[model samples]
Target chain A: MSLSDQELKHLARLARIHVEENELNALKDQLGRVFKLIDALQAVDTKGIEPLSHSLSLSQPLREDKVTEIDSRESYQAIAPQVEKGLYIVPKVIE
Target chain B: MDISSLSVKKIKQLIDSKALSAFELAGLYLQRIEKLNPELNAFITVDADKTLAQAKQLDQAIWQGESRPLMGVPLAHKDIFCAKGWLTTCGSKMLANFVAPYDAHVVEAFNRSGTITLGKTNMDEFAMGSSNETSYFGAVKNPWNLGKVPGGSSGGSAAAVAARLAPLATATDTGGSIRQPAALCGVSGLKPTYGNVSRYGMIAYASSLDQGGLMAVSAEDIAYGMNSLVGHDERDSTSVKRAEEDFTSQLNNPLKGLRIGLPEEFFKEGVDTDVAQAVEQAIQELEKLGAVRVPLKLPNTSLSVPVYYVLAPAEASSNLSRFDGVRYGHRTKDYRNLIELYEKTRAEGFGAEVKRRILTGTYVLSRGYYDAYYLQAQRVRRLILQDYLNAFEHCDVILGPSTPSVAFGFNEKTSDPVSMYLSDIFTISVNLAGLPGLSIPVGFGREHLPVGLQLIGPHFAEAKLLNVAHQYQLVSDWHQQLPAGIAQV
Candidate 1:
């Protein structure tokens, strides 16, 4: 139920959050406690029980696959951190 | 007139009778926020000119003989719902500067119902924590006891309604956000059956469990608010399509042969004595009103917190991946690569509780642990829901203490995450079952702070829950008791 510093580092990388060396130990301790609580679920016999994905067991409702939205790129891009010529500018991916 | 004490219904009557204009009513609430918000930290964003303009427009409509259900009543929006042209922060540093270009479905519905926006209330960072302490803006103080924390992530909304800053505030419950804070701050809150309200523009935290609801001075006001909030939305796939509901239709229904479920697990060892006494007395009052109490058992109730932590975080980790440094919200100033940009922005933007959950979610859903944690929790979730399904066959509604105890002082449970999570023990199961639950002030608990009684109803049974809560409010004046200094204001 406890997370090692190396595991915590890996988790932060996977989750896309940066954790400092000092914060890692404290976070590990707290997360370890949360995991201890979650560990209790392992004891419950859920064999053959369907994993309830939705509370009411609702199947995805469908509609005709047609454009339902008005194009509002300018309105949406106005809030982006970096946008140029109506396109989002992220760090270069091409070599 | 003591405008602060008026309910949504009373506010409507005043405006309708020409005793007050919508513009004047909005001004009264705005003035109260200006006076009281400094100490309570209940409001994160308040634009007086904008609010008054909307009110003035409504007044013009009234003058032109046009009327809507809740036309002039002022309401607070939990920062979680996006309000077009308003800064919708969701109580996170991540969204601190994000001005929404569109309104959430609930926000649009409220506007369509003719309510004037008062302001956006504060909340926990991304609705992650039980106490308002995790909010990036600041923690909201309980109206009843300024020193104590307001149970949250909907703490500010609850505190605002309790302090009479707004008669009603839109709130959401992923776990117990709405009910816990309402219980702590001494107001009425209702979390309808999941998918009852659209989640189109609500900042998602645990999509399956998140539900939009209301906080108000009384259950009747909550019913009034609900009338405007429920409807199907094509945008939210999970939004249930049903016959249009009149949420207030059953408010006057007598409890002559009503069956009230008393779950033994909820009343067992851990609940504080004062809360127990208050809940017991409230139950007696319901019995006197002709309700028959049925003893019930929900053995899986003990596992709710554990199951919630696993499932909620797993969903949160996936939902929050959208917060990369690109489209909206806070972005890192220094980053060399796309991955660095993602890591740095999230690291800088999310608070500790948010980060903790993301990390926990990542771990639980990681390669080897997904089945052991995530899948197992989902199966257990069914068992938890099954417990309620069984109980409902024997009883019409389930009643219990809303929280284990009254509001605790700031920092009392903040340092320990599990203790903070346990505060939501009684309320989380209701969310897992997709059932409508309500919290109403029943009596005072420790330090003479307010205690709340929780009522759980079957799926889509919001009318029954509100009817029971409104009946209790009829016999008791607990919901009417204002915070000492606040009443004088």
Candidate 2:
């Protein structure tokens, strides 16, 4: 399965990445090889086979709803590359 | 006393005997870290003051007659685990600055046991690559041969233990991050059954397959760490609620009458003859211990690489989406809009391999192709898991080479990600099956690089796996072999 430059760009956008013009051709080629490898799964007969999302057959264990808060804002914010007013600050999201 | 060289069992013994204070042990390891970590590049962060403070508190508690299993044992955690007041980067610039507000369940467990936190070890960025080359931090050099790559995503932890920077360290494996590196570095590592250890505080790579594990110089030390870390946690919905078994208790158990499965696919071509020879010798040693080798089949083995690439990356793409630069982590300073900010930040923050995976994952998980790729991969995943179940029906355990070859030189497979991914070919199937797998040093390969033999057991069969590895270690001197420079330091 060959990947078009447009599809590659779409995937890059969905993944929040920017592909350079020079790298696009290489990525397209690499993605094609990977997709070709993935094509082997097409031959497997999965009729009536349940998709295995997790290894365990067990159901999710529910916990009782409770309100709790632990304060580590000072500790957590200490590691941020940038922080302001006890909040993690990013480049201004609003123009 | 070079505390870093001591096994976890010996460290505990000294603590219990009151011969060495926890503070003193922590100080020894800190000094060792000061001495060797620069050369090895095994640790991302080393909080000597904080670790010593924790050690002093444990010492005071011991003076008051308070007892704990891992009290004062100096151990480091992989950067993937969130430790309060410590940066948990998961070796990715995406979360490079994210200090966890709360401890991961494994971190909390170690804290509760009063274990001294030496620091955070390095790893591949977001656990994506086989070699530590993909780390946001510079790649960790294998202590044995400085030019070679340390087996990775858990490369730092493995190298730390190998270099004697820390006695034991925590790691996580989605595929072979723990075992493969541990093998290459000639240390022992165990990837417990999925959900065997809580993943609450671990930075997610692949939710279903990622498991917290340990890498140490010996199987006994891995067992000791596992004993404290493995248990059900309410915070982790997937944590299993099984009776806590003492992993070290079976260390001395006889392997007589045990049936070990040797899968034919594992011994096929593409396996390094040196690695196959070492594993074969290890198997022979186990045979001398009265264990019988039985041929087993996992006919769908080749599918693991393709299946894991689809599923793990799919989960990773979703898991990594949380690092949008808005909450925490790297953000672009010059962007006209939020969308552009997200794009540039992610592009800048993530390494090449990580970006590749996210793109592959998003492509497969996209709207129109979901069934053709994601759903089909999931079905193939089940078939792979079933192969393990069927093998277990006839054998007690499975043995194989943890990696196809020993540690390759730096930049060896960097350009070829496909071949690098195949390095974990033997190890990924166990993750897919959710089975417990352990890698034990068997012998050295070319250039005296270490080779490891993998032992896989049924789900929640850590005790048995440890037993098999420990029994093998008794007769073989492989685990006793240390990298040359470590002893001098």
Candidate 3:
């Protein structure tokens, strides 16, 4: 689980977070240390045990296919960094 | 008497009896915040205009003969919960400018109960840090000693209540965020069973483990407040559908023949001597109140920190993915493309601790490491939960020190991640097991700072935990003891 600088950069990219050269060494060391702690989970034999995604053993409840929420697009989009004509403005995706 | 010295229940009674107007009490709280927030760094934002307007409306309703138990009692919210039109920074640059457009279910619940929102309290960046130092706003100083940290990410809430900036505060617990801070700051906080409190509009850190709770002066006050907090919300699919029960109904339950399990693991070498003594003395008082202390073993206790670090961060990584330069959070000032925008925005927005966690989570959940770390942690989490279930068979509730030590000095554990992670050694297991746990000011440790006694209970046992804490509080004055400048100020 020891993350090299390259591996750390890969993870940062995968997580969609930009990492500068100065910050990479620190994050690489810290994330590696955390992973080492997490490595303790490996010693326990878990052959038959079911992994729990949620604490409750209850089955997930399904809801009816109905529209329960009102559209508040204007309020929701008001805080976006860049918006124009009721549409969020981002860098051009296609040439 | 100064309104600052009164408890939430007492304030409610006076407001109901017309002895005090909600407006005046709100003004007193506002004044206290203005006076104390600079030293304590508890409240990140306190809008006097918004607070007084809400109080005036509540006063108007009183004139119209409408009253509620929590009516007009000003309360602070952890910056994590979204309250429409308030700055909802989860102690990060990411949401520093993001004012929530809608209310979290918890906020709406308090709003429904007529409670006044004083402002948002400081917390760790996305509820990640054990010490409050990780907050973007600044570290919350413990009121007991200004140099010591109020534990986080609910640090601000705990410090606010301890300093009497507000009578109570709403906090969320994920890996001991609520209880740890409450313990350090010497107040009472409860983390209700997972799925009990609705998570809608609560900024998610670890979806599976985060549970909203409250920090107040007493378990009775939290219990009184809990009735409004725990409700089924369709919006949050994880919300459990359970019959409404009064969390305070059994506050006077006699502790006679109650089995209080003391897990040998919790009292081991890692715990400070002073903390152990305070907890033992509190357990002795419980014995006097008819509780029979029982020795028990939760063998998998040591695995809690490792398992929680894996799972919580895994969930955090996935959950935080939504914060990419889009919808309502901080976006980088310069970016050439959409992908660049996403990366630069997140890197700039998140703090170092948060970025470290996101990196940790991404590493663990990545294609190669998923089964080894993520799956293994989940399996171990089940074992941790089973250990508690087994212990509960021999005892009514398990009791131990809420934190391994009292509030440590600032910058003490910051450099070492493992050291900081161990701060949550006692409280993380409860979230892992999906059970309810509470931290109460059992006694003071070094330098007269608070040491909390954690009471862990089975799933959906909030009422019993509250009852146990209430009975202990009735026999003791620790929960009543406030930091030096807080009392009758």
> Best candidate, TM-score-wise?
1
lDDT of 3 at B360: 82
Lowest-scoring 10 consecutive residues by lDDT in candidate 3 chain B?
B480-489
Candidate ranking (TM-score, best to worst): 1, 3, 2
Q: What C-alpha lDDT values do all the predictions have?
A: 0.93, 0.88, 0.91
Candidate 2 local Cα displacement, residue B204, angstroms? 0.4
**Candidate 3 residues A1-95, lDDT tens each?**
67778787788889999989998777767776887888888899989999988888877789899998899999999998888899988899999
Q: Model 3, range B342-369, lDDT digits (tens) per residue?
A: 9999989999988888888888888988
Which candidate has the top score in lDDT? 1
| DockQ scores for all predicted structures | 0.90, 0.59, 0.85
Candidate 1 regions off by >4 Å? none
Best by DockQ: 1
Interface RMSD of each: 0.8, 1.9, 1.0
How many steric clashes between backbone atoms does each model show?
Answer: 0, 1, 0
Give me the displacement of residue B138 in model 2, in angstroms: 0.7
Deviating ranges (above 4 Å) for candidate 3 = none
